[model samples]
Target chain A: MTAPAAAPPFHRPGDLGEALRLLAAHPEAVPVAGGTDLMVAVNYRLTRPAAMLDLTRIGELRAWSDAGDAIRIGSGVPYTRIVAELATVLPGLAAAARTVGSPQIRNRGTLGGNLATASPAGDGHPPLLATGADIEIASTRGTRTVPVAAFFTGPKRSVLQPGELITSVIVPKAAGPQQFLKVGTRNAMVIAVCSLAVALDLETRRLGTGIGSAGPTPLTAPEADLIELPWTRPGLFNDALAEEFGRRVAAAARPIDDVRGTAAYRRHALAVCAARALRRVWTAAHGTESTR
Target chain B: MKVEMRIDGEAAVADVDRPGESLLSTLRDRLGLYGTKNACEQGECGSCTVLLDGDPVCSCLVATAQCEGREVKTVVGAVPRPVRDAFIACGAVQCGFCTPGLLVSVADLLAREGDPRDPVIREALAGNLCRCTGYEKIIDAVHAAAEAMADEAHRAPARSRAAGSTEETP
Candidate 1:
């Protein structure tokens, strides 16, 4: 007599087509990949869906393949595999994956789940932003690719539409060294206070910086200085420039005070992380001071 | 919903009656396999840890229906004798609440990684938390188990094969 009469149907689709059809039919369904986030909500009674679209059985969603100039990582690929398999190419993302949670969580938690949850503190977001990754989203109707920077609309919110599922993410292979750094109360299994990811492309002389936790959404610094940084010139990648990059990256965030950290703390931490990340990537991409 | 799966090297079908019940609850309440603990319904704690098709995952976070036709190995029949002996020898069981999960996790580590260093051991056990916080002893047990298993492998290839076959049983 207390709870609603609707017992949600559990649809475990074995393939992408079946999953998309289920989503199309039950657009109100909550799509679950790794069940890392959805199961928590189910356990806590946070959200009661009309139906549950389980995407784990879809084999295509659990694989990665090579796109033209990039690697298309399936949305359902677990973090453990990324850390093990993609480290050489997606070094920044792999670093973030290593810092995600414990070994168990990494075995189950996924990048697509993080993006679908769209938490401001999702570790995968920063690296995707830094690598200029594109999110490939799909539905029964069609599919579309959105840049990771345009994916999030707000905290725990995304541009994902009704009946849509994240299929994969396309990240350009690391043309140069990449680095990701995070600040937490303690290292293991802690939510990010703030995190930063930096990628410098030697071929294109492009520098990308992403900020996490200290923002309404995972964001890019987008400063003209960062865009105009002389990445090819090793001497220019000094502490002063890196510090300014850190400051601008911090400024780009629209952080609010929360249980994990205060807004001021997040801003300060982001700046420090960003500066250190820049120096790390610069050194890895170019050379040590002695070598240069 | 009735799910048919291989649990602990046995074929069985479990009846899941709840709307959103986890594999942990189904195992404890329906199937009566209570070796896995039920703390922290969230995936943060590894108390309800089980091997879902040989990969350690929080059973509390797994839908019972989704485990259909897949393998699930829990602490009851999965933990090797040497691992348990090492745990007892090292005094890793304090209060005994987190032991089963820790045992399963440690067994997994020993099986997958024959020799793990201190940091790797710590990182592997990071998800399983002991409220009693006897982590030093647990680390000692993991090292001891690894060495014992290696010794067993060295001593009798046949016994080691049997253990491996039992774990890898389809």
Candidate 2:
């Protein structure tokens, strides 16, 4: 592995001001929280920032709060924290967080890093997208909250500008009965070939779905509108509707074959996750979401 | 950067150049605690497992800077006598490469859970992949160790009572 060039003078910024100042001075510098994803990039020579701003020490981005209707998750909060702290309020996100890498990865990998990397296959994306979450981005100038749906521009690309940092992701507590499922080469510590996150609101009888790793960005399946799912069938999902869901989910993905799995496999996996996700929603509608 | 970490209850200081530098590097190269083997510099292998503040994490993925001012227990200092004896009795040590890490992980689990089931033990050792022995003996050793520890805990009060009576007579 190509070692990161003696990380241009380590600077431990004390506060947001110091952090912005450092970022402004070093335009090519990278901001890292958890350092799980960035370290891999640095090692692989995929990313070479002139300097790195260690955000783990920053107090502002490490605090989480459940304020009224929405729950705000600090970008610095680790996956382990998601499982341990927010699982009850945010089960979908917690379940997705648990599936990220192993216990060690879950301990160090943060939702912020996952979002910043913006991999379509990122475990956190679909869940956040389904929640209609908003990301708070801060820089020296000011802070602005962008809807999670508009956060991604393309594959591994985000709307975030230089010198900007994601402070927190705000998700609504009353989203619905949410579920996240992913198909990987292995059960753990493997990247997702295809993944699905779906949420159903019994109060409104509405369903929202998000598909990942099958497209440039996570696709919000218009299952409720474009596809005629037998929502009234109750308990049993019609095979046609299920197949239609799978087909729509596959159509939404733009996967390219790689060593991890082929494009065909990814497409099939996307269909499977989409079908399983529909069944999961049906089951939750009837009883409870089973533990994996 | 100068990082201060507690290795086996002793304070250690080392200067690392980058944020991605692994704890395994510092332990093996700088602190000379070679017991924590480095494998799959990525976290896919458990050869670098170590207890960071009592939780088992892959040392290769942990930034040495993160461990600054934190307690780090490597395999060399983490394994207890009972755990070692159980491994010997169960013939769990095979190939000798993966033993230290596996032992450290199991020890941490047992210390936390008292007596872990086979599945719990398997999950604890999931990251630490063993090519030899097929993991049967290692799992058996962990089960044996937990039972042994539980028996000792049960008898401790009785032994103390006997000692108290003897002292009173004297």
Candidate 3:
């Protein structure tokens, strides 16, 4: 019988540069932030890496900056901090963060960790996709950015290269009303059965849609994006149009039968969440216009 | 691997046997600070909750070495009095297995919010699961603790009560 791989070497780099150097030197080192996902993997013996790069001590990755039109949230910034500090600017993301695990999980789980985990069911993905966010990835070689929509390659997978560490998530400021809702069996601390995020850019008349846990990876709905909204119309909302948009968003899912939910239930839940999210965002955006 | 951190304002060092030991294991095994419970070694259970630099987190998910030079407040040395008293008064203790972690989490919550409402209290305790109580009494304990603390604050805002002095029923 084969023996288990030896426990991975551990490094606690204090800065991003040092972390990048360690990652570059040891490409197989799994970067751990908050340990919300990675620690679970380690505990379950699901993943055994050659080394573990601890990013908790990196002060640079915990500071968010106002980057002109967008916010550059440091990869190590906890969900609790994001909810407390950035809720106004990144409402959808903050809303999603609020629904994550619980007080303790939110206190520790970082957005970068969520993005790195790349779970189809990760609560952070839908909001990032809805806001047209970009992920800033770094290595000793240099740094590069990937659009959030294009970052996920498959289930629990991303475009992150070996030796690269996620530095920050560049989330565009919410331009209009945004709504995020997740369906779950319990009220809190439960993973989403399925989730949806909708953001409407009133000025551009563009609708952004994100669906979670219904696909191979966190998915965005292109057809739903192109849906026609009659901003100039008297009532400003078409129930049938919104319902059709929900259907289109549901069509985008490649759901599978998982323990949390069946594909058919996921599809149904996605459609409901999609339609409700659309109506909520549209109404809210229009409310802003009328109040103005 | 030797991991060093301050627990409840005192420095502690754990000479860990496993190369990748969790802070939970280090606390429960090496240092014998079993106040942080150890059910569901994964991040799911809040039984191993502790304050990492004033923020409550599951110790099971924290790698021991990563806590170097940081501050941790487990239920052992940092138990809050009002929360503990209120837990007993409200009969919140059921199996008693979830008490220590629940106390730590509630202390953190009450520190953040003095008078948390039902929904807020419910939201705060959601991570610390109790199969026996079904959460109603736990919610009551949070309210009672908040009220008691608030009244104490009015009476003596400057009073500095020592933490962890109240005997916890094991």
Candidate 4:
């Protein structure tokens, strides 16, 4: 038997400036916050970066602050904190965060890590997409904000360039009731086979829907604006409108068959999830029993 | 590379060469704290659960370097006596592979909660996977431990009052 290979070296930066400088200097270094996803990949030998930049020690990246119209959540903030602290301000995000793996996984999984991973099945994406969130990225060169819609270029890929690090995510406060629903193999510790998030912006009379694990990347319904529902009158939401909305959401999906589920099954699940999420949000907004 | 941290209330330093080495590996291989079992190196199994700064996390996913200056509590030194006794009394140990993680997870839950219901206990231990005993005995162990701990807490104040009265009479 031969000896095991040594693990790669890691640089733990104390501050954001140091982290950015290190990233700028060493483009080959991969920045890891919670390490829930990245560590798994490293262990499986899927990725072999020359060095790892542990970002958990940076206090600036672990904070959440209230911006003028949006709430800024640091990338290093774990899902546990998001569920506990931001439930009232970002209910949809909190709901999505609660559905992530187990309590232990949530304790260490970070929002930034999830966004960085850009998995099609990522639980964080659908909610962020529905909320029209922005990803704040920083580099020694400068800082830039990209809309979440344009962030993911493909599966397990993001628009983040070399030497750039995701600093925080900016999500606008909910304009109305929001709900997230997911279909998985089990209740807990299961990746989403298909997920849907519905957000009703009453003030703007707009309904936003995001579908996950059903396509190449987390996607918002292109016909979101076309699916009209009576926001003020709950009784006006009929099964016809709900079914149409679900069909439109499912039509936007470009899913493929995989071991977890079939493409047809994923499309069916997305339709059901979308309809159910809309019904739940409608009921909550109207203080009535869910029609479904 | 050298990583230093407090494990089970004792300062420990391990010469971990690789950044990818988990805290669980260091605890078992270097410090000889085999109480924290290693079943799934991934975070799925939860067999290598440990308390990092009082938060229950998967030791297998946590890097040893991340524990620098942080406090870690493994099952060997950190599990309370009542929890251990309750496990044996309730016959929660089967293969014992998942017992350590379950004990640590349950201990954390019991410490923070007053008297959680059955559903809460089940949810708390959902991460831990036990191949033997089918989890009924383990749930019983947690319930039994909570009852015993609550009983002890109730008796402590009464015992203190009794002692105070005796001293006054003398």
Q: Give each prediction's DockQ, rounded to 2 decimals.
A: 0.57, 0.38, 0.54, 0.55
Q: TM per model?
A: 0.93, 0.88, 0.93, 0.94
- In terms of lDDT, the best-performing candidate is 4
Candidate 4 local lDDT, B1-170, one digit each (tens): 88889988999999977677778889998888889999877788889999999988998888787878899998976688888999999999988999999889988999988688888887788788999989899888888898899888888998889999999997
Per-residue lDDT of model 1, residues A181-250, tens digit only: 9888766888898898888888888888888888788888888225456544666657777778878887
lDDT of each residue in A146-248, candidate 2, tens digit only:
9989999999899999989898999877445788998876777878888888777666667777777878887777643255545566645555566677787
| lDDT: the better of candidates 1 and 2 | 1
lDDT per residue (tens digit) for residues B26-57 in model 1: 88988899899999988887998899899999
Which candidate has the highest DockQ of all?
Answer: 1
lDDT of 4: 0.87
Provide all candidates' interface root-mean-square deviations.
1.8, 2.4, 2.0, 1.8
Which candidate do you rate higher for TM-score, 1 or 2?
Answer: 1
Question: Evaluated with TM-score, which candidate comes out highest?
Answer: 4
lDDT accuracy of residue A176 in candidate 1: 89
User: Candidate 3 lDDT, tens digit per residue, A116-168?
Assistant: 88999999999899889999999888999999999999998899988898999
The candidate, 2 or 3, that scores higher on DockQ is: 3
The candidate 3 chain A region of ten consecutive residues with least summed lDDT is A283-292
List the RMSD of every prediction in angstroms.
4.1, 4.9, 5.6, 4.3
Identify the superior model by lDDT, candidate 3 or candidate 4. 4
CAPRI docking class of candidate 2: acceptable
Query: Clash pairs of candidate 3?
Result: none
- When summed lDDT is taken over every stretch of 10 residues in candidate 2 chain B, the lowest stretch is B60-69
